[model samples]
Target: MIDCAFKLQEQAFTLRVDHRLGAARTAILGPSGAGKTTFLMALAGIKRPTAGQIHVGDQVWSDSDKRIYLPTHQRDIAIVFQDSRLFPHLTAFENMHFARGAKVTTLQIRQVIEALELDAFGHLMPRQLSGGQLKRVALARALVAGRRYLFLDEPYQGLNRELKGQIMDFVDLWCRDQVEQVLITTHLMGECSHISDEFMVINGLGPTFLGPLHELVQQESSLKQLMQIGIENSLACQVIANECDFIVAQLSATQLYVAGHAKVGEQVVLKFRAEDVVIAKEACSMTSAQNRLVAKITQIHQIDGRVLIHLDAGQPIYAEITPRALSQLRLERGDDVHCLIKSMVLRVA
Candidate 1:
């Protein structure tokens, strides 16, 4: 658990936070210039807070009143900045060795290198590597360090969607097995939805909001903050079977067929953009969509000419439609609707 109450003056505003984050994995979200990076730097001990305290478990990392400040190197935390901050003169392998010192074993080093797909480029210098390769090397260094906490600041910014998904999967598995806590900062909601158990939102310099994504979606203010990046529906399900064409997962009482592979009985989260959902007043028998669920509209919110429909189909799900569709279908609160989602559109996060 991380308990923090601090204030830091940025160039534009004073970033104030008073929150206790107990989740094992937390994702930080905010718009541009919202101090998302600043908040992360403070926690990593890169920037000292102007006042208050920071406590991670039983250790006091920072306390302004006591004049006690722990340096970044002493915090037992590994951070990947927005830029791949590797040593210019060192090769990728050398950078990882430096970060791990003499403590990491050869077997552990090889495992991390393989996990991150860094073996081919390990001999390349920082200047010789591409943007995506540099990011992978930075991540490998952090993993070799074997820190208690892992902080990722927009770690997937430069990668393509397919590559981003693959690296996130690797990082998720590593965090579960090795790290005590993980905090990632990203603008895209679906990028970290699979790994983050909870979310922390920093809107400007005001108080930050922290909670499970499902709970945060219920609140209008937090929902607005999330929608800015792109609102995505994250459904927790358990894989029941893997078929020839698609994987079958059970979401409560409903069965969801998604385009992915996972072991049977493994728990997974399915994420899709709200725009991908099509709502109908009745289920069609000859539709091309692979999945359909009977849901009841619990809330209808109109934001910036778009309609956001909140539904309950054993579990909370959201869909977005234009005002024209909303009026054509005559969708209203408490009405029963069918949610049509294509299997190809669904992603296993």
Candidate 2:
């Protein structure tokens, strides 16, 4: 468990956050000046809060009433910065070596080096390493030092999507193996969906939301304001049945077939882009699409020569179509339309 309640007044801005989080993994998301970094700094003991207290599990890191504040290095937490802050003068091996302490064993450090695939370039200095290599070294150093919590600030800044997924997968495994809590700040929605289920969203006004991804995605206004065009419809679903490669899921009262592998009764989050949904006047049985439902169009939005249709079959779903197609089909509010969805386009998380 983690608890933090503090009021921070910076030179140009001020923020007040008070929340308790019990999730083992959480993603911190926000706009550019949302105090995401400031909140993290306070949790890591890098910044002193003007008031209130912070407690991780049974330990107290800060308490203004008691005049107690822990120093950064003494907090037993590891932080990976956006710039991959490695000692430029030291070799990669030396950089990782310096972060090792009495709490973390030498064998543990060796494990991190191998896990991050840093054995080949361990002897090279930070200046001679590639962008990916530097980032891996930074992650390895954090694992070697992090005895409790791990903090990541934009860990996927310079990497491509494929590499980002690979790095995040490894980080997930490492945290599970060590049974540690990780708090990461990321701007990419895709990474957040892949890495964490619980999240916290903050702005200049401080924390606005903190809960499961499914519940948070249901907030249309907040979701649109934070993600903008990247917003995808999310549904809390359960696997009812599986046939070969096809998995049948139930979203509220609506049942849909998806292509995935999951055990019966397993709960999952179903996500698909609005543009992938095909809106038609009637369901086409001859098509290869596996899921088709009749829904009423509740709202229609036009942007960039395209239309976004919000509908409700059982739960809310969004479908996007071109303006020309919309005109040809004559779709409007309160119109009943068939939403044809392909199983392959569905992403289960």
Candidate 3:
């Protein structure tokens, strides 16, 4: 079991938090400047806190009241950075074993090398390694160190998807085989969600958000905002080549291109902002509203002096309504209505 409570004040930012961690893989997730790195740094004992208590099962690394502080080496924690940080002068083989005092020995090194698929590159120099190779080496180094807890501060940030998967698999397997804890941070929640036993959200510089990934994904409004949407229109979209910034999907039915995340053959619902929709209280024949969806009024709530109208668009959709409009139209639940949507509001998300 691990329980950490600490406070750190710097010239640029002030971070304070308390959390209890059990013996399982956990992730520390936050946007940029949310102190994810700072929290990990403190966990690794790289940065001592002004006040705190750090405790493991039978040991206490820090207790401000007693004026007790343990150096990083005594904390039994290993951290992997975004950069591999391997010595360029050394070969991959030498880099793994040079500092023989690592937490794991030769047998462990062999296992790590196999798990991370670094056996082929072990003989090569750091400079000869590709981005993925460097990342694998760095991971091996951390696993070879053999700590009770592992801290990864965006360790896979710069790598491509395939490469990131390779290293992430190794780490996952290692934790499964050992008695350990993991706290990693990543901006890509979709990919990271698979590797995390529990997911947490850290927003701003105060009040860290913690919960199970599934629950957070379902109930947390913040998580919805973080999601990368994939929209598959209910029409024929000819497959075009994918570009870096956006996917070029030919909507023959609509004659438009929108950015999205989709494979060769997939069916998805298109996404749009609520404000992009035009609301009408009265009935009218279908005019030239490019994408008009029929919905039933479910509920209405006032948000910031504006009405947030809930519509059951076969599915569920939200539309912003003003109080004056709601009063003027006498909108209520069970009212059938047509929503007018502009093509420009349609986005691949």
Taking every candidate in turn, the Cα RMSD to the unseen true structure, in Å, is 2.0, 5.3, 9.1
lDDT of 2 at 53: 95
* Tens digit of per-residue lDDT, candidate 2, span 199-277: 8877756346777655665565455544442546667789999989878998766688998778899987777877788
Clashes of each: 0, 0, 1
Q: Which stretches of candidate 2 lie over 4 Å from their true place?
A: 101-111, 218-221, 232-281, 284-349
Sorted by lDDT (best first), the order is 1, 2, 3
How would you encode candidate 3's per-residue C-alpha lDDT over 1-349 as one tens digit per residue?
7778888776667778787877377777767777777877877777777898888778887788888788887877776777778889998878777633445667878877877778888999999999878877886777777777777777777667655655665677777775388887776553342346676666544576566643453343534433322111223355464555444455432333345445544433344555556677665646555555577888665544555566766456666656887888888878877677665555442
State which candidate has the highest lDDT: 1
Candidate 2: residue pairs that collide: none
CA lDDT, every model vs. true structure: 0.86, 0.78, 0.65
Could you tell me the TM-score of candidate 1?
Answer: 0.93
TM-score rank order: 1, 2, 3
Maximum-TM-score candidate: 1
Tens digits of per-residue lDDT for model 1, 1-349: 8999999987797889998988889999888788889998999888889999999999999999999999999999999988989999999999998899455678878878887788898998999999999988998898888898988888888887777787888888878988888898888777663758899988765667899878887787777777776778878899999998689999877798998788899998888898899998987958889889899999998876777899998878889899999999998999999999999989987
Query: Candidate 2 or 3, higher TM-score?
Result: 2
Model 1: which residue pairs collide?
none
Preferred candidate (TM-score higher): 1 or 2: 1
lDDT of model 1, residue 293: 86
